[model samples]
Target: MEKVTISAAAREGIGVKGALSKIRAEKKIPAVIYGGQKEPVSVTVSVKDLDKIVKAGKNTLVEMDLNGAKELALVKEIQYHAVTDNPIHADFQRVSMKDKMDVVVPLKLEGTPADVANYGAIIEHILREIEVRALVSAIPHEIVLDITPMTINKGLVAGDIKLPEGVELITDAEAPVVHLAIPKEEEAPAPAPAADAAAAQPESSSTKGKKDEEGNLTKDAAKK
Candidate 1:
């Protein structure tokens, strides 16, 4: 995992009402750094710097420059504008190199499954991310699982993913992350039954038997 230095400055207040609005107007994101067994500090970071760190992955370790003071932190949460999709606020949780933390790592699938090309089986990616426990500096940004050798109906489970040295898998071992599923044959719907088909059609007009002042079969059995 690569660590990035994030420049930050101390804020004036604990972000009371209207304080964040002012910070956002200046194109700055209001953030708070808490934990690491220290007093929480109100801070602000530029939106550009924040996006770069976030794009790298939240699991990325941040070297904070709090108006010149230093601290190591983890991005805990970020609130975004629903309409504009811009960062509104963020929270950074301080962490130490010695502390083991559990964090979610995005799952990346590598190589196409053999069944997909050979048998036209579909690959169902179930779990896109998983949790792992490791030291602050040891956390990985993503987990890559290879499916090149997978066959039809075969899958890679959570345990199949190999973690970096000194990292521990916190996700369940039996949970399936990705799998190959056989495609269902598109069978034409069954033909309608014969009797039902007949009922569906119009009935033929009834024949009027020949009659001499009477409706009855006559004259050589209706000329059989």
Candidate 2:
């Protein structure tokens, strides 16, 4: 498991709101450390440093140096500015190295399924991450599943995934994460009706069989 090192100072003389705004102006993130039977502490960290940890895309282990007191923690939640997409605040859960904690980890799919390659089936990913419980140090960065032998109608559910030693899945075992199936194509629309059919055809017999008074009819009169 990779750990992120963050430097924080024990905040003083300011409320959370005031500190948070100041942190944001400095391009830092305001965070709170709670849990494990200690008084919650408010702190601030550089946005650049926090971004590196968040890019891992999961609840990651954090090594925080708070006013020279080091602690192990996990990122519990993050708040972002609705308009600017900047980090507004974050929460960290203090943890003991010996205790187990529930965390969500990313899922990585390996190898193209046989069905997708040989049978022209489509591979669908239903879930890209899952929750699990494990000791703080034993947490895995990602859970990888190989789909090399998968064929049409074959799938891997949460239960089918293999875990590293000491890690246990917390998600429903029957929940499907990946599957192979035939692709569905959209059907083309029917052709439109012709303009004649839509507007009604002209009356067909209106001029037929008319005659002139020469009595050979107009046809013989015109021959003269």
Score every model by TM-score.
0.85, 0.78
Scored by TM-score, the top model is 1
Candidate 1 off by > 4 Å? 13-17, 193-224
Would you list the C-alpha lDDT of every candidate in the order shown? Answer: 0.85, 0.82
- Cα shift from native, residue 22, model 2 (Å): 2.8
Model 2 CA RMSD to the hidden true structure, in angstroms: 5.4
| Model 1 root mean square deviation, Cα atoms | 4.7
Model 2, 76-104: lDDT tens digits are 88898899888888899999989998888
lDDT of 1 at 148: 88
Candidate 1 lDDT over 1-224, as tens digits, reads 68889799989756378887889898999899999779998889999889989888759888999877899988999999999999998999999998999899899889997678888888899999999999888888887888888887568899988888998988999999988898789999999866764356543344233445664556745675
